[model samples]
Target: MEKSKIWVFVSVLCAMFVLVACAPGSGGSPTPTPLPPVSSYEKSIFTVEEGPIVEEKQLMGEIVPSRQEELFFRASGFVTRVSVKQGDVVKKGTVLAEMQVDDLLNQLQQARIDLEVAQANLAKDKAQREYDIQKATAEVTIWKMRVADAQLDYDRAVGIQKEKALLNLNIAKENLALAEAALKLVQENTNPYMEQAVKRSQLAVERLEGLLAERQIVAPFDCVVLRAIIRPGQQVDAFFVVFVVGDPSELIVRSPYDFDLASKMTDKIEVNLYFDSKDEKGYTVSYLPNFLPVTTNKEATTTRSSGDYFYFSLPKEIQQQDLKVGRTVFLKVILGRKEKALLLPPSAIREYKGLRFVIVQDGEKRRRVEVNEIGLKGTDKWEIVADLKPGDKVVGP
Candidate 1:
C-alpha cells in the first residue's frame, strides 16, 4: 500500500510539470510577442518647379474625309451608259456614266451652224456700212465739182448778164449742202444690230455645248462611289445628285467643345491629337471653321463644355496610312499653356467647400498652403504660378 502511494504522488508531480511547460508564455517559442502595427500614412515631399504645363482638354471626335460631294450632272436626260456602279473606286475626273445625248449633239451642231451664219451676216453688215460711207464721200466730191462748175457758169453769166446761169449756181450750192449733210449722217450713225445678233448666237452655242457635256456624269475626285441613284434608262432631272463620291485620303476630325472656352478661341490655337492607340505625335491639332454641339461627360466634375463643335481637317500623316472615316478618337486641345511654372500633383491638392488647399510638409511640421491654380500640367497636374521653391518633393500621382 505505501509503494502504491509513492507511485501516485510521482504521477501527480509529472502532471503538474507538463501543465506548466505547455502554458502560455511558460516555455519554447513563448506566444510570439505581438509586433507593433505599422503606420499606413503615405508621405509626399514637394518642391517648387518651373516647367511647362499645357492646359489640355480631352474630347472625342470622329474621323471623316475632307470632301464628300454628291456627284451630279446639271442636265436632264436618259441614262445611257452606267460606267461605274455603287462600290466602284475611281480616279479623279473619271467618267461615271453617260446620258443619251444624241438630241443634244444635234442641237449643238445646229447652234454652230447658226453661229457661223450670224458671223457671216455681221461681216457683211460691216462691209455694207463701209461701202455706204465710201459712196457718200464720192457723191459729196461729185457735188463739189458740180458746185464749182455752177459757180464758174454764174461768173460767166455776170460777164454775159444771163439769169439762167445764176439759177443753176444756186441749185448746185443746194445740192452740195445736201451731200455734205448726208455724208455727216452716215459717218455719225453706225448700226450694231448685227453685232447683237452675233452675241446671241454665241450664247446659244455655249448653251448647247454645255447641255451636251451635261449628258455625262463624271467623278469629281479620287473617290469611292457610295451610291448610284440613277439606273440605265432612268431619266434624271437637272442638278440631280445621282452618285455619292467619298475620298478617304482627305480627312478631318469633328468634335464638340466647351462653349466658354471656345468663345475665347482663336483660329491660331495649338492642338495635340491622340488616336485610339496610345501612340503620340501622329497628328497635330488644327483649327476648323465649322462648329458642332458641345461635348459632355455625365460623370465629369464639369459635365458640359462650351456649346460648339470643332472641325479640323486631319493633317497629312508621317509615313502613316489614311485614317478610317467615322472612327472615334480622342483629341486633346491645349486651351491654355504656361511656360516654366511650378507644378503639383492632384494628390497634394485637397478641396474644401469651394476652396483648394495643399498640405505641405515644411521642416517636420505639416502646414496648409493656399495656392492659385495658374495653369495645368496635364490632366491631373496643375501648374501654379505662386511663391514656391525648387526641391520641394510632391507626393502625388
Candidate 2:
C-alpha cells in the first residue's frame, strides 16, 4: 500500500510539472511580442524641374482634290473612245474622251437640213418680199398713169368750164383719189412681207448658234481623272458621272483632333504628316488654314472631334505618285512644347480645376503642392513646373 501511494504521488508531481511547463509565461523562455502595426501612409518624391516638354496635338485628315468635279456628257451620245483612264492626268480641252460622232453627225446633218430649210424659207420670204415690192412699184406706176389721165381730163374740164360749158371735173378728181388708195394698199403689203422675212432670218441665226455649241466637248478646269465611270461605246447623259476628275494641286490632308485639344490651338498652327504609302523622311510641315471646317462627329470615329478635325493641302506631294488628288493620307500635328521640366508619374498628382496638385511627404508630415506648367512626360506621367524642390517626397503611382 505504501509503495503504491509513493508511486501515485510521483505521477501526480510529474503531471503538475508538465502543466507548469506548458502554461503561458511560466517557463523562462520568452514569448514573441506582436510587432507594432505599420502605418497606411506611403508615397514617393520628385523635384521641381525647369525644362522643355513638347506639347503636341494629333489630327486626322483625308486627301482631297483642290476641287472635285464629276464630268459628264453635256449632251447625249455613245462614248466612242476613252482617251483617259483612272489616275490619268489631263489638261483642259485635252479631249480625255470622245463620243461616237455618228449621233452627233446625224444631229449635225439634221441641223444642216434645218439650216437649209431656213435658208430656203428665208429665200422664199425674201423673194416674196421682192415680188411684193415689185408689185407695189408696178401698181404705183399704174396709179401714176391713171392720175395723169385724170389730170388731163381735169384740165380739159377746167378749160371747158372757163369757156362756160358743162363739164365732169368732179368725176376726174374722184378717179385720182382712188388711184392713191390702191398705191397705199400695195405699199402696206410689201412692208409686212419684209418684216416676216426678218423674223425668219433671226430664228435661223439662233439655230446655227445652238448647233455650233453642241459639237464641241471641252473640260471646264484642270483635273486628274480619279475613275472612269463611263466605258467605250457606253451612252451617257448629263447626269452620268463620266469621269471623276479632281485637281491634284487642290489635294489636302484631313485629320480629326480631339475637341478639347482643338480648343487650345491657334490659327496657322504647325503640323507634321506621314504618308503610309510613302517614306517617313517625307515629313512635311504645314500651317492650319485661317478658318476651321464644319464637320459632324456622327460620321467620324468619335463624336468628340466633329469641330476639331481639319484639312491641309499636300503642296509638295501633289507631284508625287500615289499622292494624287482625292487620295487619302495620315497626319499628325504638334501644338505646343515645354523644355526640361521636372516630372513625376501622373498618378502621383491629383488634378483639380485647371491647376494640378501633388501630395509630398515631408518627414512624417504630408503637404499639398501646386504644380505649374504641368507637362506630359510619358504614359501616365507628368512633369511639374512649380514649387517642388529636389528631394521632396511625392505620392507615387
Candidate 3:
C-alpha cells in the first residue's frame, strides 16, 4: 500500500509540471513580460510661426447714403404743386414742392391794407394834435394879455373902481393859469396807444412774409429725389415729411448701436461689406473698407437706455460699384489685427499657476516653456511672444 501511494504522488507531480510548462511565463528566458505597451500617450502639436492675421467680427447692417434727409414742413397746408417726381436729380436749393399760399397771400394783403389805414389815421391824429396845440397856445396868449390888462386897471383905479378891476383881474389870472396848463399838456402830443397799433400792424406784415416764404419745400443739398409723398392738393400737417432726398455720392451704412458697444469701439474700424445682390449660391467674399463712427448729440439723446445712431461710410473701395439709394449690405467689422505675428492654436498652450506656457516637442520628448505675453488672435488661436523661435514644434496641452 505504501508503494502504491508513492506512485500516485509521482503521477500528480508530473501533471503539475506539465500544467506549469503550458503557462505563459513558464519558458526558459520567461518570454520577457511584454512591457505594458511602452506607456505611450498621443499629444497634439503646433509649429510656431509669424504671419499676417486679422481678427474679424461679422455684423449685419443696412446700406444708406451719406447725406440723406426728409424734407418737412412747419405749418399745416395743402400741397398746391409738385415740381419734381421720383428719381429726379436736383441741386441744392431746388424747389421740390409748393404748398398753397393763397390764404397767406390774402392775409398778407389785408395786413398791408390795415397798415396803410393805420398810417393815414396816424397822419390825421398828428394833424389834430398839432391844431389843438396851436389853438391852446393862442388861447393862453389871450388870457395872459387879459391878466396884464387887469393888473393895469387895478393899478390905475382908486377905491371901488380899483376893487372891481382887481376882482376881474383875479378871474382872468385863473383862466390864464388853466390855459397854460392845457398848452403844456398838448405840447408833447405823440399818442402811445396809436404808436403801439402801428408796430403791431408792422409785425403782422413781417410774420406773414415769413410764413409765405416757407410755403415752398426746397432741397437742402444736392440729392436725388427718392420719393415725393405729397401730390397736388394733398393736405399735410406741421413737420410732415413730404420728400426724401439722398446724396448718393458719399454712400454709407447707418446702423444703431447701444451705448456699450459704441463706447468700447475704436474711432476708425475696418469693415467688409457684402452686397445683398447674390446669384443664389451666396456671396463668398465682400468689399473691405475702414469706417468712422457718426457723432451723437448728447443733449438730443434724452435717454441712452435705447439704441443710439451710428453710421459707416460705404467703403471707398466700392465707390466704382453700382449702387442704389437703399441697397442692402452686410458688414464684417475687424475688431483687431496683428501683422506678422506668431500665432498658435489654443490647444498647444497650457496654463499652470496663473502662467501661460506652450509645450514644445523634441522628437518624443516635450517640455513646457513659459511665455512672456500672450494675446488672443482669435477664438481658437493665440498670439504668443516668447523665447520660442518661429517654426518651433508646439505640443498639445
lDDT per residue as tens, model 2, 1-397: 9999999999999999999999988858786799999765543445444455665554555665645555555567677777778877878877777665555456556666666766676677768767766766676576667656655665566554644322333454465566567657655654454456556655655665454344334555676776676678777664345566667664566665455665655556666776664546556656565433322223222212225455565556445676655445666566555656675666777777777788877778878878777556544446667787756678653
lDDT of 3 by residue, 1-397 (tens): 9999999999999999999998875777554566666533454657887877777655566665555566766677887888899888889888788788888899999999998888888888989999999999999999999999999999999988988998999999999999999999999757987777888999999999889767878888888877677898888876666776778676666555635455545556655567653423223332322333222223222212223445665444454554566566665656678777888887787888999888888788877788889764676677888878888998775
Better of 1 and 2 by lDDT: 1
Return the top candidate by lDDT.
3
| Deviation from native of the Cα of residue 339 in model 3, angstroms | 10
The local distance difference test score of each candidate is: 0.72, 0.61, 0.73
* 1-397 per-residue lDDT for model 1 (tens digits): 9999999999999999999888887756745688999855565555556677778667788775555666666677778888887667899878888888778788888889988999999898788878889999998999999989988877777555568888888888898899999999988877678888889999999988777667777777788776677778888776666776678776677776667567656778777677764766547867775543222323223222224467776666633454666668887777777777777776676778877766666667766666666466577677765556666654442
Model 2 lDDT vs. the true structure? Answer: 0.61
Clashing pairs in 3: 44-396
Give the range of the ten consecutive residues with the poorest summed lDDT in model 1: 293-302
Best model number under TM-score: 2
What TM-score does structure 1 among the candidates reach? 0.46
TM-score of each: 0.46, 0.47, 0.44
